[model samples]
Target: MTDVLVLTERELRAAVSLDLDAVDVVERAFAGLGAGGVVMPPILSMAIEERHAEVDVKTAYVPGLDGFAIKVSPGFFDNPKRGLPSLNGMMIVLSAETGIVQAALLDNGYLTDVRTAAAGAVAARHLAPATVRRAGVLGAGLQAELQIRALALVRTVPEVLVWARDPAKARAYTERMAASLSIPVRVADSPEAVVRGCDVVVTTTPSRTPLIEAGWLHPGLHVTAMGSDAPDKNELAPAVLARADRFVCDRRSQSAVLGELRSAIATGAVPEDWPVDELGEIVAGTKPGRRSADEITVCDLTGTGVQDTAIATHALRVARASGAGHVVEN
Candidate 1:
């Protein structure tokens, strides 16, 4: 009988916070998966029912070395009003050679958030300067907090600035996260204020229009745009992308279609000769990061499925060692 590891959201959260080390996991996974190998992550799409306020079933699959992981997520946005989380999802991991179902991770969305935040930190680790000490975070939701935590782990940033459309949430985030992280967290009046004096800026909003503009950035600023995961979503203006000396992304095709590259290319702000680098290339040392202190950098993240696979693998290993999961009989 083949052993299948099952992990819950709570366990996955604990794993990522202490042992999983998302920055390393995401960086290595992208490097290994991007070596002209088998890993492939396609974009995910779904429709919402106006009547039921639920998303219709959608298709998601990522093919890679170990195998493929399929995502199945449901929307329950009103759950928060009822004192519950609004998002929930699962991962179905299959065998590479035998094509048998290996494991089912009932981690809800915790694993995904960890991997996504880790990916942001990985991007910032490569694109941001080593001396960076101030960070600006847009959007005060789960992802924004996670990005701040993960980035702090990878770098020595001692202060963080947060901006949210809602002032109450922003103040609450500053108060809560600052105490937990032992860092000075401040709430900014606007998105521009959040990035104006910061060395690194991370945008986590789901805005259709741009939030961070080009004029607000100074020399040596590193911007990690994490909000634009879909085609219709974009947080950074094309001018902001044009101001960067170097541009990096996780997946080239996806970024071109849905990420900052999409708008940049459409507006002709990023020419054909623009220096576009992949996060995997930087992790593999095929490309350099932060060559100069005055070089402006931007990293557009679309969240790769390979990252999901990597974290899931790590979760299974830890779960098995801790005897934290149950075995379902065949």
Candidate 2:
């Protein structure tokens, strides 16, 4: 018989969150990526154009970890109209030594949400200016608020600016975030406003076209574009990469085909062979990040399989210690 721990979203939430610890855990995973020898593959993705949905499967095997995770995440943009969440999925963790199932994290995308937000904090920690008075976010989805919260973990965000296609959602975001972050939150009239007035900006929308122009990039501005996991999604103009002093990616090869780098390359703003550094290299201290506060920095985070493996491992450990999940023997 094999025992597999099964954790629901509520149990997983009780075990982990968008905190500094979560950020640190993800940071270490990036470092492992930098150190190399981790077996991570390109994401396997499928599109359901009829339903306006995309499902992604990601996994990575780290050298030191005892287990790895295979996560299945789906995003249905039109679900909210039917009173359902746009995002939902789960992670399956297996033993690295024997390839046996260890845990089934039925998080319904909650773990993805936490780890992605933690990655934003990781990017800001390594790349953003030391002092961030204001942080601007381009989406009013749950991630918009979490990104601001994650940014606050690495840098102080006394003011927050948000812009969303739906004015009602933006208003709701501003109100709710102000109370949650205990900082002043305001709705921006345009994406330009969010980028121009803040030292740090994070684009969390799955925008098809460029929402942020290169002209809006100012000195000391750090932009982390986290929404472009697919070839079709782009948040910043391709030229924005050329305008930045330093361009970083979670993974360069993946970014080249799947993230903002793809858009930049497609438009010829950045060369096909542009020299780049991964966030992992920076975290591992093998490469430099944010050489000067006045330098403009852009990080393209399409998300990574390593992040899923790390977070899933952490959640399972916490659940085991806290006795949070049930186990089924088969």
Candidate 3:
């Protein structure tokens, strides 16, 4: 008989808090990936067009880790109308040595949210300007809040400008974030306004069309587009990517197929053979990030399995230390 731990969302949340530690774990995962010390497969995605939903399966094995996680992430865009969250998922950790089931992290997508936010923080830590007074967010969802909070960990953001399709939602987000973050949060009139007014911009929408354009870019600007995880979804115009001084992605191969890089390639904005740097390479110190203060940098994050495995591993460790999960025999 084998015993496996099962961690509920509440238990996991109690065990792990989204902070620099989470960022460090994800950064190490990326470094391992860049150094070829991790075994990561291409994401397997399935679309349910009729229901406006998509499911992605992602996994990775870091060489020295005792276990790895396979994450099943499902996004049903229409679920919000039914009073349900658009995102839901879980992770299953397997023993690296014996391939035995170790733990089931029933986070219901919470861990994904934390790890993704941590990745954005890592990007901002490495790519954003040294002094970030104002940050702009192009969404009013949970991620918009989380992304800004994550950025605050690495940079000083005194104010945030937010834009959303719905004015009421944006206003509500402004109120909530201003109070929670203890900073001024204002609503921007448009996506361009948000981009122009802030040195750091984060796009967290699930838009299928371009919300930000190239002409809005300015010197010393840093953009992190985390919305386009699927082939059909795009938040940045191809020209935005083409005009950036440095363009980075979590994984070039995955980006070429499912990220903003794919959209740019599809639209002929960037050639298929164009050289794009990986965030892992920069984190691993094999490549440079933001060489100049006036450089315009952009990072395309389509999400990665390395992040999942790393975050899951960290969560399991914390949970074990805190005795936050239950052990079940099989």
Report lDDT (Cα) of residue 81, candidate 2. Answer: 100
Taking the tens digit of each residue's C-alpha lDDT, what string does model 2 give over 1-330?
Answer: 999999999999999989998999999999999999889988888999999998999999988988999999998999999999988999999999999999999999999999999999999999999998889999998889899999999888789999999999999998999889888999999999989999999999989999999998899999999988888889989999998999999999999888999989999998999998999999999999899979999999989999999999999999999988899997
Off by over 4 Å in 2: none
Candidate 3: residue 173 lDDT (0-100) = 100
How high is the CA lDDT of each candidate model?
A: 0.78, 0.93, 0.93
Candidate 1 lDDT, 1-330, residue by residue in tens: 776666677766655552236568667787775555644646455656562334422222334445556656666777788897777888767767786777778888777788888898888777888887789899998888888887877788889999999999999998889777988999899999988879998899889999988999888899999888777888998988888788888877878887888888888988755667888888878888789999999999887777777777667666667777667755
Error of 2 at 165 (Å): 2.0
Q: Which ten residues in a row have the lowest lDDT in candidate 2?
A: 227-236
Model 3 regions more than 4 Å off: 49-52
Candidates' TM-scores? 0.90, 0.97, 0.97
Instruction: Looking at model 1, report the run of 10 residues with the lowest lDDT sum.
Output: 51-60
- Badly placed stretches (over 4 Å) of model 1 are 1-3, 18-20, 51-68, 76-84, 271-275
Candidate 3 residue lDDT tens string, 70-179: 99999999999999998899999999999999999999999999999999998998999999979999999999999999999889999999999999999999999988
